[model samples]
Target: MQYDSISHFLRTGQEHLAKGPVALIFAEDDVEINTTLRHHLDLGFSKVVLFSPAAFNIAPELAEKCPRVTLESPRGEPMFDAVNAINDAAIGVWLYYCFNSEYLLYPFCESRTVGEMLTFHTEERRDAMLTYVIDLYATDLETNPNAVSLDSALMDRTGYYALARNDPDNHNHPKERQLNFYGGLRWRFEEHIPADKRKIDRISIFRAKEGLKLRPDFTFSDEEYNTYASPWHNNLTAAVCSFRTAKALKFNPGSTFQIQQFKWHNSVGFDWHSRQLLDLGLMEPGQWF
Candidate 1:
């Protein structure tokens, strides 16, 4: 189970700093971290780092299964701090993906390596990253049953821009409105925002270049290529940048950069982050589900 050790490193650590062509970072909360760690290790990423905000609850023998893995104490802003530390090291092409345990479906959706996907984008287009969507299910259900082939399921289609118009009616039906109204006035007010106004599907992939800094403002825009979004609202407006970006923006580990209140367990963060990336024109809609 040496691979289990590697899998643990990938799932629960931070970003892999070991010298390599690529480094994979998995920021996870609660769930069996080893499952995700093992999943990504099979995806061809040799160096992996896992970051967790809670104490390791697995049995001592199971926890010790991953020797090379580095465990860091949980902090208030573990995600931001871990990412910053990894980017500071400036390893080769950094591909960052964050999701809850429920989102990752294996043998992974595609049989392709992360490096292979990035190769599709030229060096000049490094800022343009690939995006994908996770079909959330209450049980073990799939939205697309025809997804027997990873090629058909995971291919990067064209015309997938992030910040486009969305159907408000589709998102806010009478049932949704009723739930919000019954909940409180604040919930109703939150529902009043337009669907297109909310950013949803995007991911960040790039090589950390010199002088690049993560916008300390942490908020991002829904407009194409607008990297200046603030992270204070309920929207997914934070920017994922290199350690250099964190340093430039003067981001402290304990400081709160993005603030919003929502039910954390139901995949709202992933949905919001994806939308923000699309709205800012940093990602294409077709890349996502």
Candidate 2:
């Protein structure tokens, strides 16, 4: 099933949006789109809404399960606008959003479902979960020219670091429990990434509320929702292993020639396991044990 516009879909796509933990996928490219869709479906996303200009040709198998909304020049609106459009229905519901080439990873994600993770997170009295956007790319541009490979994806194991987050309210005092995270592809290829885009931390998982809005910088309008945890203590965190940046770098006509090779000394074959992300401190395991 498909809709010509977001408004129509929001009005009639009740089957998909009726439940919670909706996965909003903005399909910019068809690379592994079927697999990405199937991944979220497998993880228990009650609704999977895909917004794309061109139809993902490989998604016929799951077409009935997911609805593809035709977006004219989808890039015109920031992703948050789409989320906010359905903000009314999303209130008090678990919401997760990401692009085509990114995958959500939680502690012990391989063995658990996203619904389970959210259930546990909600039990701990948390409204949002901070996730590190760990960059993923193909080691061999020859074997994987697109810089994306579901089977043999490679990621940096030891380049992550964080500095005190400068608070907009008060520069003298940094935001409590938050940091300006850095490293991975953005750190190595700083020339391509912008200063405002360098931070890899995102609160991708959150419980939506009335008037809630996701800012362009990956934070939320509600200040507490943007915090790393509750005012008193730390909460569990997750990871988003993304190939979005890598795929963009390799596909962009300008960057393609400049980055003929992506492999360097720090490059290592990603184990494709959650343990690697946890071991590197990219994700926190607070109260998950």
Candidate 3:
């Protein structure tokens, strides 16, 4: 169902989510997922699922270190089907799903607990999008002062926009907020693209309770257009999508679509979807938590 405002969306039986559980799903390659799981478990996440490509390089023993981690091997099944299994079995559950490379930035641990984080207003829940700040220097955890800068050039080249930190926010919370930094520069992307388009690279967190359906024909490509498909996104950008909305897209993981289009900002589908959500009045500013 479509919503005109956060309040309207909240009033649509979405209020039931306030008491649900929250889960996080990460891919096997994501080393940061280990850290994120530790943080979440400390905050009280009861169920966390890890989906790994059968050939993932990370050692299973490493993932086993986290008590809350539950690994799922997506070897032969389609991606959506795997996600659906989690959603169906875990309905009434809130999800903060993301790649191993992404980290939670706001409502930090010292400032709030996992229980407190899940207590979002219906409007906030419906319009809320999870955003990641790239810590190019990996200083978010070490220094009290954190820096954040928006790199438009990188956005231009990689089709993804990133924020870097030169200074720090001395807000004084519990632990220094963690940053995902396995690659040369430690950073994360928030992938929130439209449902109709192809390819997405940004990390995302979703709420399973919303019941959004995903389109089975979902596919991605590097070229602008394919013989049987449309260009995913001409701009190549990504953002976090609502769990309900993401489910509605029904993306097929096993399709022959090229993974090259999956990089940040190379797929236009997410950019258009972001615009559509804003234009439809379905999204609200300051809603990202």
Best model per lDDT:
2
Name model 1 segments beyond 4 Å from true: 1-16, 19-28, 57-76, 102-109, 128-135, 140-198, 215-289
lDDT of 3 by residue, 214-277 (tens): 2243211111111111123111112333221111212324321322221243312222223443
Distance from true location, Cα of 65 in model 1, Å: 8.8
lDDT of 1: 0.33
Clashing residue pairs, backbone N/CA/C < 3 A, model 2: none
Q: Cα deviation of 71 in candidate 1 (Å)?
A: 7.2
TM-score, one value per model: 0.44, 0.94, 0.39
| RMSD of each candidate relative to the true structure | 14.5, 1.7, 17.6
lDDT by residue (37-110, candidate 1, tens digit) is 56555555545444443354434443353233333432225444444445555645454544323222211125
**Which candidate, 2 or 3, would have the higher TM-score against the true structure?**
2
- The lDDT values for all models are 0.33, 0.80, 0.34
What is model 2's C-alpha RMSD? 1.7
lDDT accuracy of residue 188 in candidate 2 = 87
